[model samples]
Target chain A: MKEMFYNRPKPLHIKGRVYKFGDNINTDIIYPGKYLSITTEREEMARHCFETVYPEFLKIAEPGDIIVAGRNFGCGSSREQAATCLKYFGISAVVAESFARIFYRNAINLGLTVVIAPGISKKLEHNDIIEVDLKMGIIISKKNREELKTIRLPSSVLEILSAGGLVPYLRKKLGVEQ
Target chain B: MPTIAEKILARAAKRDQVKTNEIVMAKVDVAMSHENADVVIRAFKEIGLKKVWDPERIVIIFDHRIPAESEKSAATHKRIREFVKTQNIKYFYDMREGICHQVLAEFGHCRPGEILVGTDSHTTTHGAFGTFAAGIGGTEMAGVWSTGEIWFKVPESMKITVHGKFKEFISAKDLILFIIGQLGSDGADYMAVEFHGSTISEMTIASRMVLSNLSMEMGAKVAFILPDEKTISFVRERTKKEFTAVLPDRDAQYARSLDVDAASLRSQIACPHAVDNVKKVREVSGLKINQALIGSCTNGRLEDLKVAASIIEGKNVHPDVRLLIIPASRRIYLDATKAGYIETLVKAGGLVLNPGCGPCLGAHQGLLAAGERCIATTNRNFQGRMGSSDAEVYLASPATVAFSAIKGEITEPC
Candidate 1:
């Protein structure tokens, strides 16, 4: 039997600088539909991610950086590229007050870590170093170690995320060798 | 006490009953994709899957970029065709077929009490048939393609009951737009909306389709119009499949309930930039428009086309405005042509395109330039939804769109 390498959640104290955004950060801004015919190449998409809204987003974005945003983050379209762009660019996780329904599903489907942490954005400042415990749903300020509570994901959703996404989870459940 | 959505979802999940907030693995009766099939195919391959769990349950439709607009699109079509052939997928519609939602409806792929998932957001249209249909991402679709099942968090139900009769020129489109405006865009976020009462019951299948289709406008996960004789007869004429009708129990709990007097509503519109930014037609009328489009899964049905044609018959499209007419499906297209609706539209200077989702996503045909404004019968008016980010798109009924096309600006239908 091939032992499955699961993305099991632990107290992932990811240390990263915060890149803050506002409410209703739509998918169109994240990944424009104009490029649907071009390609969904991760690097190319990452380059253009948030291009119209925040020019030079890719240039400013670094690996292991966290995205903090206000209400209804990822609020437009069911395109997985919104999640893919951020995940491909090595975004540690997206911590938002809330998320659009489809964007939330797409993010989870893509194995991109996103948490609903109400008022987390208000507590965050630009470039604030932060540590997030993925399993426990806690966000701590590395500067002051001040903790913020995030809405805990259901056990079922946690399983899918911790398995790296639905695909790996299904594969393991079906005993399909990768 | 189960809501209609819960009833269908529980049956699909093979459970006695499933409540709101519960998670369950439900077998999908149908999984759908359009030209986006290319994306799903790629994602499926990336997952290292060889064969889809059930080819018969998979449906691939080519409506987004039909007739191969570009080399990239043509190549994508070739890939989807090859995948369909190799997998022996049973349901596949080429460019000639109308929109995916229409195709699913005419083919009876989404029967009552069934579960359907698609890559397009408007997949919520199937909720008119009492099916638990919702959109998913291409990657998530690929996962369902592999597993034949997908996990769903049973959403809480919101009851929207409308009574009374409609005024002149009012349609399901107007009612839904009014509701969206009232509820705001995120009112029903992550919830199932159950539409009920006499007004909804009197609506035709196509009209009901508009209600369910635009439910997503308010962020509803799915919308249900409980199956009635109209639904049964419509499904019967389309397919002979025996299916159980799902209905909400009398005591079913709702997260919230809203009441609307349908008879009191007039023509409504959603203004620029957001689906929830709505205004009464008279309030924003005569705002010069450059184009008018009547189509999309939302309002491209034959009935909608008939309404547009009736208003535009013997009338020339405004010299300054361009009118684009797209049928939701080839069946609707052919029916409209036979009924002379197409010829009337053409004589009015309306350009009838092939039966596909043309220009709705701003992919091709009828794209707008900066500083231009358009009134579309389709749902969603989010900024840049039709073309240039600077262009404004307004959502309205077919009658409104056709009349506005003749006036060269937003106008109330006679």
Candidate 2:
């Protein structure tokens, strides 16, 4: 049993204060297009994230804050900065009813944690303490005693996440990034 | 039963079959990019690759920020040009070409059964040609450049069946907007949406382009309008290269299906800040607009220009509205000029801009100020998409936009 457990990775958990948003929060609303040509750095991209829709998002944002959003979160543009901005801003994870397809895949490719929990948006308030267990596929709302089940991530996605995004994963597979 | 996406993806994967949710390293037919090629270049350099896998299979068009809107854009374009020259890429188009998607189809790089990946989301527009096209991040695109292959999780298929004839002024744009409204933004999340039925069958290649372009709004991984006579004819005009068409199995299993009655649908507008926040044109008719734009990858084709010209001919644009017309490509621009569409539009007080994605993505051209509103033929209506966060954009068809440009407000054609 000890030998079998030696190689098992630890379960990943994220606990943070929630920053809530409404449905169909698109990539433009997350990272406006005007700044695309200017900001080439992830840290620079983080500064402009949600600056258009929520003007004070950057000012009030803190490390380990999680975004709780309604359905179709991150829709519209396929800009990966929308996810990168949040990730670099120290957002631990995004818990939403759903995510736009490209943005969801971009997040996974970037190793930014994203969780899908139906009705999770309505259950949490701004600044509510929430905990998410990626391995267990569950979310616990500290505001209330109620618990919510999250969509279990596919094993392939889990593999990519463990490898720290597609770039690093490809680096390893190509045997280049020593 | 396999869908068009599955068939193309399977061939690219070189596998007997693939199932939904299964990851496969499918080979790429073409890697497309725009001004964002600089970003891809940086990622490629980070991957420690001195040369791309295949120079012939990469397509770069300087459409998004053509003519270098600012110092930043100019620098990015310089880097992109340098990279293109050094790589000896043949399919690269300069600032005067047009939108990436439109140019790709016009030049015959996109064909049925081929797999295309790009750095822009609207890359899905190529699926009008029945290609397995999807958008990826810059890093992922860099991987494709290095390896000529990318991974895909086969998506569940959704069939959208359209029937009945469209009423006058109810173009393909209206039908797609209606579908997006019904499906919501995430309705087709992680799924391949296949447009089928009589309406799609009768659609021209340009009209089918409108449907596949806006399908991105519904969170589709890839959108498809299967090959038909119109498609084959269109492909024949562009390229002499032989290619095979991939079709969905007769009994292909779709996880979800929808029915659209085109006859009953009205002219629709996606209101401020959301593509799915759609309503019939009558609901907000006469609402004042300051700018009326009739162009973008979504509706900037020659057919769209002809429709707008037919509507605005022999009439002046409203004094309050700035009516801007931009054709999708230089070829379309020349064709429109040959057909007198540009003359009718300009004579009617419309400003004909250069043939590119001018001001569509809010990088330059006609950006609205605070408290202003625009009626555009562009795909997105997201908040701040056109300029100021306080400004609003209502998306409609070219006919609706032209009609509204005359009225300086949102209105359906009488």
Candidate 3:
């Protein structure tokens, strides 16, 4: 049988430039509630994803950019839009010291790579090219050629990311009868 | 053995009990979104998720920063509209719909014996209907979008039983504030609170929502009301969907149970910085106010607005106070307007804003300036929560807030 959503046999991989931030990067700042009325397209959202925290975010973000931040990233409301906005804007993954529970689940379910890399916020700089091996919990900056930083991931989460997210994984695991 | 929350989570994961810090996949019965739908849609594209797991279970509301308050907000709205169309997700409410929590309950998205996760902290409001609802972050919400499942840590249960009848001047808001004062901000961190007793049974669903909504301020993961007849009737009226009848077992265990005598309770206030810094209204009686706001997912219901209107009726707000009134939703706004409560509020020198999260989140409308003092009917008055970090917020019942607006100081209604 084909592997279901986010149910890859191996861990997922993410390579992107880093966008570092502090703790408590709330939903309001990520995708400010005020902008909900505008277009829902990824392009439009990508333009404004981090417009508040950093005005030049969209211009600087590459297709596979990653966000590295302090503890409690995505600390406000359960708006999936905060994670979605980052994804919409081409953020391949978010590596934070910690994440608000709901945001962590949303990112994973949506298939946006999310990892907890304690102290990554301090070592990474804006636009730093980094590669993450989800199964191995390893992050390496090709530009710096420094020793790889390792972050731990549970086997269960690795399975989900490998399957490409929940829906596909469930379809494979539970069968797509419905 | 596991608690109800743990039991439900285990069933979702097809497990017996989920240990702490173990990531277990489970389904999200409901996923609510405000103006930030665009971001979520974007995440879907980046992750290459095909579609929302269940579009019908998705409720997208436009509450915070309504009326396209700015060019940036207008862009956000456009993104949400596009996503809604693309996903073919139903249950979309525009800016006029009202706060997401109120609309979710009124429209019947929340029901008993289910786990509902929202993208807002006040999603706990759904507990009034006996559903296990909690807030999550956007990334977590994205996971719910793709798989419809999320993880949870089994929380220890704290049972709070409020018995007896509430005095005329004491409302549910005061009752919760009083509890917070006793428990402190981190009092119930990572715990589930079960509100029981005669008073809870006697209170209306709207009143119960006020209590549950503020549970987040106490750092609780979930605040729940045991299913009763009121819960049954509420669900029956809202949807034709079936729900499992959920109630605590006779021999169920609890971490602790505290009995609160409501009849002897007084109107209470939670001072600035911490919700646990609570005091009786009379204790802080003469403190002047720069603003008084009555609305939020917590206390912004028709019943709450009616109570506030009654207090401020035929009375002018204090010259020093800027009184603001925001209805919980469009339905509530219409009901209040039809009942002449809007006129009463306007006549009392109050400004009525559109039905949205608005001042409650300090995003738009009625945000206080530095060193300003505000008495609000909303939940949580933590430092820097409303506007400036120095701005002080005093939480109170709607009536008490309205009366304070009239007196320009925190005061109990006569």
Q: Which is the leading candidate under DockQ? A: 1
Cα lDDT tens digits, model 2, B174-247, are 99999999998888888899999999999988899899889988888899999987888888899988889898
Q: Which DockQ value does candidate 3 get? A: 0.22
- Candidate that scores best on lDDT: 2
Q: B1-414 in candidate 1: lDDT tens per residue?
A: 889888887888999999789888898888999877777887676566678999888998888878778888888888889999999998898888889999999987878878889988788898999988898888889888988888889999999999999998899999999999999877888889999899999999999999999998788899998988888888888877788888899999999999999988999999987788889999999899999999998999999999999999989999999999999998998999999999999999999899888888777888889999999998877666678888999999999999999999899987
Interface RMSD list for the candidates? 2.9, 4.7, 5.8
Cα-based RMSD of candidate 3: 6.3
Clashing pairs in 1: B98-B329, B165-B263
Chain A TM-score, structure 1: 0.90
Considering only N, C-alpha and C atoms within 3 Å, which residue pairs clash in candidate 2? none
lDDT of the structure predicted as candidate 2: 0.87
The candidates' DockQ values read: 0.46, 0.41, 0.22
Between candidates 1 and 3, name the one with more favorable lDDT: 1
- Greater DockQ among 1 and 2 belongs to 1
- Write candidate 3's Cα lDDT for B1-414 as tens digits: 455666666666788666544556677788987765655565454445567789998889988778867887887788788888888889899887898999999898998878888767878788778788888755456657877877676677889989998888688998998898888665676677889898999989899998889887666778888778888998899999998856766666778778899999988988875567898888889998999999988888899889988888888999999998989999999999999999999998999988887776667787778889999998766455577656889988998998899999888877
